[model samples]
Target: MDRNTVEKRVRELNDLLNDYGHAYYVLDRPIVPDSVYDQHMQELLSIEAEHPDLIFPDSPTQRVGGEILAGFSKVVHEFPMLSLSNVFNEEDIRDFDRRVQAGAGHSITYICELKIDGLAVSLKYENGRFIQGSTRGDGTIGEEITANLKTIRAIPLKLTEPITIEVRGEAYMPKKTFMKLNEARDENGEEPFANPRNAAAGSLRQLDPKIAASRNLSVFIYGIGGDGSAYGQDSHSDSLDYLASLGFETNKQSKRCKTIDEVIDFIESWQARRQDLDYEIDGIVIKVDGYEDQEQLGFTAKSPRWATAYKFPAEEVHTKLLDIELSVGRTGVVTPTAILEPVRVAGTTVARASLHNEDLIREKDIRIGDAVIIRKAGDIIPEVVSVLVEQRTGDEMPYHMPDNCPVCDSELIRIEGEVALRCVNPQCPAQMKEALIHFVSRNAMNIEGIGERVVDQLYTSGLVHDVADLYCLTKEQLLSLERMGEKSATNLLTAIEASKANSLEKLLFGLGIRHVGEKAAHILSEEFSTMDEIAKADAEKLTSIHEIGEKVADAVITFFNNEDVLEVLAKLKSYGVNMDYKGRTRQEIPTEGPFAGKTVVLTGKLTILTRNEAKEQIEALGGKVSGSVSKKTDLVIAGEEAGSKLVKAQELGITVWNETELVDALGEKE
Candidate 1:
């Protein structure tokens, strides 16, 4: 085929696929069958592969094709993405209404929208083509995530009409999608996300666009970035309609109410029916409809006075506490869990809840066989809200934490300045089991085919006593275990062998040293470049590094001093485990730069360079960029619309530099 003919066909295919995708994903109406869509998508993919030069940015095949990003850059919003003040009850709602009326000096129409339980994002378009997308990092600044956002089919790459705009939305995962994702995670021996909101956020923040695409996320565009009147719309409702007409997925459930009474009724109606929806809604957002009224009511430093959110009260259920169970963690901390009679709360069955510690148990006066009110904290963790002492019978037994470790029979000791009891014995079986599990976890060694259950089986069968024992496993031994087929045994051994090549940071994190988390592990690995260097460092040398405190230094010294730990290290070394940091080394901070050893705070909007670029430049010149202004702050770089941080810097007598001054200083350093 001729180039012109092929180009025409490609254009036709792009249009058809975009239209079909919009109908199916955004409007929830499929204009064509799944087979037809797949056929066209496959054709597009083949054509794009054949003629890479002809591939357009908005091509159907271009949605998820990008190299994994090292990190997200900062984006300053053209207009601030303000938050809404919260209204908990009817009284607060009525108070908001009164304030709006008093501020506007007239009656007002209101728009009520479902508050989607997901991440807030901003989408920017130039000439009706999607240009950039970002997160709501701080209202003023956000992280760029255009590649990840493009994977969401609900977000149109091109608008119906060519016009420049910036809109805000909530990106979310449907309940069905969330369940499927958790099931996949379970099968892969990965930790399941706590809620759909977290799943959505995690998916969007992925460095790889293909990962986000696989998660099947969607977005609901709620409002424009600035004012709706600029788009020739008089009110918020009208603006939503305009957005829908422009191929944005605006929520259709939003209602225009003439009175606060109608708004209250709408809120109450959704509060009961929220569970029936496919997605999660934490609350209802109430906003004054007319732009004039909203402008008149104005905004506070944090949120708009014309709008407020009515958060749904957490669902509480009463259940009988059957018994308290204890578990030991990798760090030997003893945790108490409450086994409860099965009861539904927040659309899930509650069989157990964490008691946190003995102090909480005694303070709440919790007893076995007592009726307790339970609720999901932030719609995720189930916790005991209160105990119904009046409903409790005399047969109820008082619960007390055991004095010894249940699994190892070791005496438990309460560490000074800590709440929970700990088993100091490093040889505790429970601790070893937990450590094995952590060693193979996603953020650590990342050995697939090994989960909590597999760890338990390995420990019980005496096949693995420590993490090092995992490297010595044989396929024959694995196949001897129940439900372990030959193929499964081979896969587990392969994964264990593969993990030996991981960088030093992964191994450090897997070791589960006290006060050493993933971030700390990475920092230590980068600073020392090798495990041996880290082990050889003294507390003074360790504490000299930024973000490393005396506590972490002490913990590192103690961990390296242990003979058992040294033996494990020698075994790992003998097994060919890599101990060198393989990741990119951070730039060294110069000691002789103009801003050397200075703590600088950047506030407001930067016009010359992005916030991230400024931060990098500052750090490159041996200056540390802090998020907030304090007495410790040596300098403040104030830009356009500098707010509280600027004022605080002035009040604290800190040296302040405007954008021009900052540019000059950077230029001098260069």
Candidate 2:
């Protein structure tokens, strides 16, 4: 559109937005669907970009942001976003009361609220309109993700009162939304999100407002940012009321306390009842209610002394370890898998789980006969907790790695300086089953509504075995399986038909050779450009490739050299499994830079690169990568829903950088 047309369009949008704001805010009614409002706002942005002169002061886009900021400019809090002092047990609460008595010499009141498991965000309102919103980046400074924040319907675009205030709260997704998102992603052949916290953080930082809008995000206002606006109230409880008066979506779960004992009661109640809540809450935040008491308790450079968060125990579940079985992969690595008594853990009913490797098995002392415990550590990944050694049987055997391929009966060998036992057998039946399973996995082949059960059924029924067998399955064959209706069989066949045209890397990943994970497969496919090139590559050349150490190189070389593997490849080729690789290595990567001398801890989900891909990039940039965040970390690439590492980064005041910032830092010559 022309500049004049753009200007005319923006004005019209602004008028419509103002009416919607009035209807939704002061009037307590919404005239448009949230999605429609979001789309209208996006339309204004596209127009304004081409005609900068069309941008107006009162535009809805102006509420979000202008140019992208290099980083957040620091702004001191009108009142500190104080850290809560903790009370681990009842005695600690009594101690807090004793301290309050010594200072106030009178009864003290407290306010308790759910500490939502999400990144803290601060939103500022000026003269009845939303002005600014940002992350709690380093407490004092945060990135201006205003455009994305504006897309969240829960965050009001305008306020009811003609008063300025800053609101502090958690930005999180509901449990229902999290599940829906995961399901949708799985259906679309994308990786499922780890958890709600991760889903929320990822949605909020989206560069495209449309992505943010599609997520259906929400937030809760916890506190008013300062003393001025809370009307005749000098207490924390009153501040929340003031925020509510401004039409913010404040949680009604907060309770006003008459004493520290009452505060403890509220905390304990939530602590017990948190499991029933729809959203994940990591803890409860308790604060001294009065502003006068807050000042008396006042500031440390790092945190305010007024409040503290009481963290919940990690999610734990216990079930019997029926047995430990050895599972041979397509690469013929005999890893131990724990067969449990079919207990539900972390939303999935896990009857079997990976023991990781031989080293981990030995370290955990996990015996087949023991009653084992499992924990979803930090509500994310599930791992074995500990074995109830007292329940062990005298007949329990000490586990050992196999000396020969359990499937192909080939001599097994442990690579130098590694713990896993490898079969290195290309024709191993077990590896073929495992690899074929992985390839047809929902994330890989995206077979609609198909899971391990369906895959196992297909394998058992002899309708499929290797990756290429999927191409040979007939509708008549699929319909013969139990519970497989004609409609479902047709859908499965259609999905399988579509999967034959998947990218070459996916087909490579489906092969599941030892040490060749999805990321590694992608790298190999992109580098070699064809299955023939990869099959022909020598060990030394394979090892020379990035992230392919000697062990992985040996495994890859050994697999390709086997005659059976060549025959399997020929079969796959006949059935049209993609053998043509088409990825270009970003060849201009620097071998030395500031990152070269650094040790970085990557502890969260990267919104773009897969974890292994990020690890490779970090190594290529000349940095050593560590799994956990620590004091020794020179830099940390903080990503969506960063966990303990983010806390550690804050504790040390380490240079915690985001992916975008990390890329920019790499762009620097130094």
Candidate 3:
């Protein structure tokens, strides 16, 4: 085809695909079949490949991921993304309503929306073209994740009108997607993510855009950034409607309440119905309907006075406990699980519940074949609430803690001052599987695509037996596994290879050493620059460090002294796994600049630097930036419309600097 013909066809195809995608994803109406959409997309991709110059940022074909980013850059929001104060019960909601009424000096209207349990992000558009997307980091500054955001089909790449605006939204992974993702992780021998919120956050923050693309994330634009007055929007509800008109996906479940009573009713209605929805909503956000009312109420230091969130109470259900099952963890703890009759709870089927320890089981008087109430602890883990002794059958049996490991048949022992029954066998198969899963988890090695199912397949197939064996895995071997294609195997190999460059803290945490969490791993990495130093250090040397308790020190000492651990360490070292910490070491800030070594708190609005910019600058010059003012605060940077924090700083006799003075101090530091 000629250049002109190709250009014309590409433009036509772009519009066609974009319209179809919008109709399908945003409006939830599929005007075209999957085959039709795929055919056009393939055509667009082919044409784009032929002529790279024809490719545009807003092109429909660009939704698929491209390059891997080194790191996310910081972005300053045009307006602060202030948090909403939480109201748990009816009384708190009434008090908030009363305060709002008093501030406005009139009866007020409110907009109630489902507070989606997901990551808050801001999408910026220039002349109706999507330009940037960032996280709500520190309210003012956020990490730019434009590439990752582009992968979310709900977020439009371009608007219908040529208007410049910034909109705020919650990017979420739907409940179904989260479940499928966990199922995939289970198949791959990886640890399952706790909730949809965490999975969404992790997907958006992935260094590789391809990872985010694979996650099937969605977004709901709530409101525009900065004052809605500029957009000729008079109310928050109107702004939401305006966003919807501009091809942005806004939650349709939102309601405009005439009074606080109506708002309470809305919240109550949603509490039961939220489970019916595909996405998760932790609470209901109530906002003053009118823009003027919002302005009148204004904001406090941390949150806007015009808005509040009413968190839903935990949902519980009753089920029958069938039997007790024991499973060994990475640390060899044989945890008892209550296998229950299948029952619907918290929007999912609950077949098993956590029985923390024998003491708790006895305390609760739980028995097999007894009817027991089950509730999700923190809306994630299922646990037994109470045993219905009255509903218990005569054939119900008393539960007993197992004295030996179920997998290895080794005797289990409870340590002094510990309630957990630990299997002392280091070479237990269950322990090995759990350890491998932990090694490739998000907080550990962060090796993407290696999940629980993959680990099981590898272990059972004799392809891998330890963490070091994972690093030596061939792409051919990965391709031999079920459902692993050439492309996926290549990506997995790349991810595995890249993890070798991670800082020592990741390796430390991935090792599955008892009591060594991410924070503890970081502390250990910072304390000892090399793994050799930590391995050789005595318990006395470990305990000398702050926050390193006797228990932790002994655990560390014991972990390093194990023969299997030493062998694994030697193998890891030989395979070029970095043993030296490459992250920043903890040190005292140098007292050299105007803000040096001082604890500084910022308040109100500023014309020069945003809150995060000021914080970063102060931190750059060795000053510590704190969110709240206290006795320890050496200085408070007060900007226009300074609030309660400014008053508190004055009462504490702390030094206060205006924007101009702060600017001068920054200049002097430079």
Candidate 4:
């Protein structure tokens, strides 16, 4: 095709793709299937590659994030992102309404919106094309996050008409995404995020755009950045409609109320049903609708007088702490749970709450028979917030954690650098049960039809004693268990049999070793081809590998040195379990290269490869990658906006190379 034909086709494709994207993302409606969209996108990408000069700033292809950034640059907002005044109760709402009425000398209309629990962001557009996005930093200046903002599919790259505008919105992660992220983090041996709001904030602040993209962030535009009159908008509600018309995602739940009483009703309705929504909301924002009314109301020094936020009262209840019960985990960590008097909290009847550990109990000074304030953390897990000291009576008894395991009467010991007490007894029935559950978990051996209920029944019936004994179950034995029929028993046996062929990493994790997690298991399995080899490795050998620290190495060595572990390994081998590591790690890695046998520290961020992807390639070529900079570092791979690690490398006189140099050394063509 000629240049003219290519240009015409590109324009057509862009229009079609943008419409489809807006429908799917902003509108939550898709006109075409994903496959159809992908096909058209492929055509667009091919044409753009062939004619790079024809690529426009708002091209759909630009959404696929390009480079990793070392750091975010600062952005100054054209208009100050003012905060709203807050109201706590019905009296405060009535007072605010009275003030507005007195100032205007007439009745007024109010717009109520759900105040989303998320990070605030400002998006700027020029000529109907998205030009930049920034965080709400100190209201005047913010960090540039254009690349990260682009990853949010709800954010449109181009508007419906060629109009310049700046909009403010809340960027948030949905509850489902937050749960999945925490689950993955737990499996990877990383600390779990406390709540969805924190997760969203951390994700948006990530220097790497790909990291932010993977977080599944979404946004809901609430208001224009500056004066609405410039856009020919008369009211806050009208501006919201205008934003929606421009293909921006706006909260449809926002309602225009004629009086403060209607606003109170709206707030009460949401407070009753807020949990039903997929996102979290901490409050309701009430704004005087008309721009003229807002100006007349004017601004207080720190907040807008025309707008106020009503924070929902936290759901908390007073309950007596009856007793503390202990439960042991698969890894032998014994956790204390508080037995509480039955009470209602956040629509659920609560009788128990996690104490976390003894430290929390001591910090709160909780006592048996004392009244404690309990609330659900993140509206999910019930926990004791604090003790109501004034409610304590003379009969209250100070609580103390048991020095022995509650299940087996074995002495408990606190491991070094750990907060919880552990029962090291290998024969503890509670540990055995927890280990069995972990063995069949989705992230472990992935054995289906074997849940905690089945594990409990099997343990109680004397059919399974340890992890190795799972393969020894018979059809008759399984059929005897409660709720187990012929079909279910057959399925359970099949799943158990299938798990025997899992890779060495799964089996290693299933064994319930102390400090070795799924990631460490994978690394050890890759370094050593067989289970016996890993078992035979000394602490020094384990510590020499990348990402394996002294504590983990010692834990691995201590676990494998046990006679009971040897017996279990032998039993598993006899049961036909695959003891050899079968993974792509070894076969895919090149043995010799310029990076081979070198310790590389990748600092800042690379433009091309993500941190994980770069680590894989380096490890594949026999190079070891460390997380931090040290004197032992052989080379530091620096990218744009390199930080302390790069400075440290220079101070230490260590070699440093930019991303291009590393790419050249790897013999890869640009």
Top TM-score hit? 3
What would the per-residue lDDT of candidate 4 be over residues 254-310, giving only the tens digit for each residue? 999998889999999999999999999988999999876775676765688888999
Q: CA lDDT of each candidate?
A: 0.89, 0.72, 0.88, 0.87
Candidate 4 backbone collisions, by pair: none
Residue 499 displacement (Å), model 4? 63
Model 3: lowest-lDDT 10 consecutive positions: 583-592
For candidate 1, report its TM-score. 0.59
Candidates sorted by TM-score, descending order?
Answer: 3, 1, 4, 2
lDDT of 2 by residue, 1-670 (tens): 6666767778889778766764674346899999988888788778778677777655666544334444434555444555555555677667767876676657778888898987678888778667777877655556666676776656777666765567888888889889999999999999887678878888777666567767877788887664422233457777777777766777889988987778877888888898799888887777777775765565544565667666665566788877778777655668888878877665556677678788998898877767888865544456778888887767666677777776678898887877788887655767667776677774466556566677778777777766767778888887888889998888887887787777778777766676777768777877777889888899888888866788778878877887877877898788877787645443434456768768886655677666567767777776776544444668878877676567767888878888888767655744
Candidate 1 Cα misplacement greater than 4 A, ranges: 1-115, 118-153, 157-218, 221-279, 283-313, 584-670
Predict model 2's lDDT versus the native.
0.72
Maximum-lDDT candidate: 1
Q: lDDT tens digits, residues 309-397, model 1?
A: 89898789999999999999989999999999999887678899999999999999999999999998756689999999999769999
Deviating ranges (above 4 Å) for candidate 4: 317-370, 374-670
Prediction 4 TM-score vs. true: 0.51
Pairs with backbone N, CA or C atoms under 3 Å apart (clashes), candidate 2: 83-307, 84-307, 84-308, 85-307, 85-308, 329-431, 330-431, 596-622
Error of 2 at 503 (Å): 50
Error of 2 at 118 (Å): 2.2
User: Is 2 or 4 the stronger prediction by lDDT?
Assistant: 4
Error of 4 at 434 (Å): 47
